[model samples]
Target: MFTRILTSALFAGAAAGLIAALLQLVFVQPVLLHAELYEGGELVHFGGDSTVPAEQDLGGLSPVRDGLSIVFTMMIYSGYALILVPLMALAQERGARIGARTGLIWGLCGFIVVHFAPGFTLAPEVPGVAAADVGLRQVWWFATVLAAAVALWLVAFGRGWAAWGPAVVLLAAPHLVGAPEPEVFTGPVPTEIGALFAARAFGVGMAAWVMLGGFAGHFWARETAGRDAAAQPA
Candidate 1:
């Protein structure tokens, strides 16, 4: 079981990590860049002798920072996978029957609940800065999850196409509604930095959860199959 879980996690984690990276690079980066261009311009024009420092010219140091970031990110995802795989097993034991696809959905749902929803309120910013009010964000997150779960459940249990719609809706909803951008134009850090961070965080966290779910699903499937085979009259 441990071996199965580890193998499944590794495979799922790799795929999930790739997807997460793509999301950040494709969706999140563009949004943050646009926000930065818009808000930063305003700050420069209005602040009249702006006190904000120039963006950090990290130069060669960027590679180092990026490497460390990747290492830490992977570590976080791996840890998350370890925790989630067992939960998935327990869910399966309870007759949840969460296959690979459903596992992915469950993982994504978890991500939305933990990172994205909380982010709506926290509105990522520098440590000292006040985050935006999270109440509305929390509500939206809950609503979205409930809607998605119902849709997925209907599809999974009802054996219908309608469930796919909810899955699609779940995947696209976050991108459509978008995460909150930082309002205040702070120091050297670009305003869009916050948004970028939020997006990356969301993407990475979701990816981690998805990978974990996949692994869990695989383990469950294998274990169930083995049990059934063992019970069959030889």
Candidate 2:
């Protein structure tokens, strides 16, 4: 059973990751490239009380960088898939349906837990932007993710208001607790550019997660069907 699940996760995750990489190349990479210009001093938001021609930082989109980016995306998304598939298994045991359809919803829910929920306080950042300390941000992020995950599980699988009430509280906990804040909003990047970058990043993530969930669910169902047929008396 574990082997089946792992195999399904690998194949599905690789496919989804590749799809996500392509998406990031098209939609997300340009924003990152733009931000890096400011970070690297190639572009100055206000230079010498007037405008000046910024140096090209096109190297951000180079073939080497793109290649490494794809590799990293694949690794990260594969990890996500591994975590997601097991949750689907748990859902299955709880008498809930688990399939490509459910997977899409689950994927979106996962997005809410990991990205959307934490984003309220964190927002996406560019290289030159101010931020809270890395260690503190990470601690807060993990706590938020965990609270949201538990809340979602309760909403999905928990029995009654007794369960539901706690779930709501858990869902609200992170927002109430709040994320660490940056002391100053100092940065060379424009607010519009930063906002756009964050939106595109989330869009790319949603696409990849949808693909991962759909593929994992579809493949796992097929694997289960194959096993059942083999066991049935001929």
Candidate 3:
């Protein structure tokens, strides 16, 4: 079972990560490069003195950087898979169906727990955004993700008000306490560019997660069946 879980997660995570890398390169990278121009004072917004050149191209792709990005994304997604597959097993043990179609829903839930929950209070930031202390933000982000995950599980699988009641509180607790914030919000990145970056980031994330869930489910089913077959009489 342990071997099955590890192998399935690695294979699924690698496939999904590749897809995610392509999507980020195409959709998210250009917006990031554009925002960096503002951060570096090359492009000024709101009528500031600027050193802007006409027909500027936001092309900063490099082989080394992109290669590293691909590798990093794969590792990150694989880590995410390690968390996700065990939960799928638990859900199966509790009599929940697991398959490609259902995995899409699982993937969406994983996205909500890991990404959307934290992002609700702390939206994705550009290079030059004003923000809270890094340590505080990291603490809050992890707490929110943990709270959201437990809350979601209770809502999905828990029985009666005993479970439902705590689930609601868990979901609300993080938001009620609130995320740390800057005293005054200010940044060189324009609102339009920032908004676009956030949107694209969410889009790419959803696409990757959906693929991860499907692949993970498929591999899990395959491995389990293989094991069962091996144990059966000839």
Q: Cα RMSD to native, each candidate? A: 7.8, 2.3, 2.1
Q: Candidate 1 — which residues are off by over 4 angstroms? A: 1-7, 18-63, 126-190
**Candidates ranked, most accurate by lDDT first:** 3, 2, 1
Q: Candidate 2's residue-wise lDDT over 97-141, tens digit each?
A: 888898888888888888788886788776688888999999999
Where does candidate 3 have its weakest 10-residue lDDT segment? 47-56
- Clash pairs of candidate 1? 121-134
**Per-model C-alpha lDDT, please?**
0.57, 0.84, 0.88
Deviation of model 3 at 88, angstroms: 1.0
Q: Cα lDDT of model 2 overall?
A: 0.84
Question: At residue 27, what lDDT does model 3 achieve?
Answer: 93
- Name the top TM-score candidate: 3
Candidate 3 clashing pairs, residues 3+ apart or interchain: none
TM-score of each: 0.53, 0.92, 0.93
Query: Residue 196 deviation, candidate 3, in Å?
Result: 0.7
lDDT by residue for model 1 (28-106), tens = 5454444444355543422446565445332232456445655555555566566566666666766777577777777
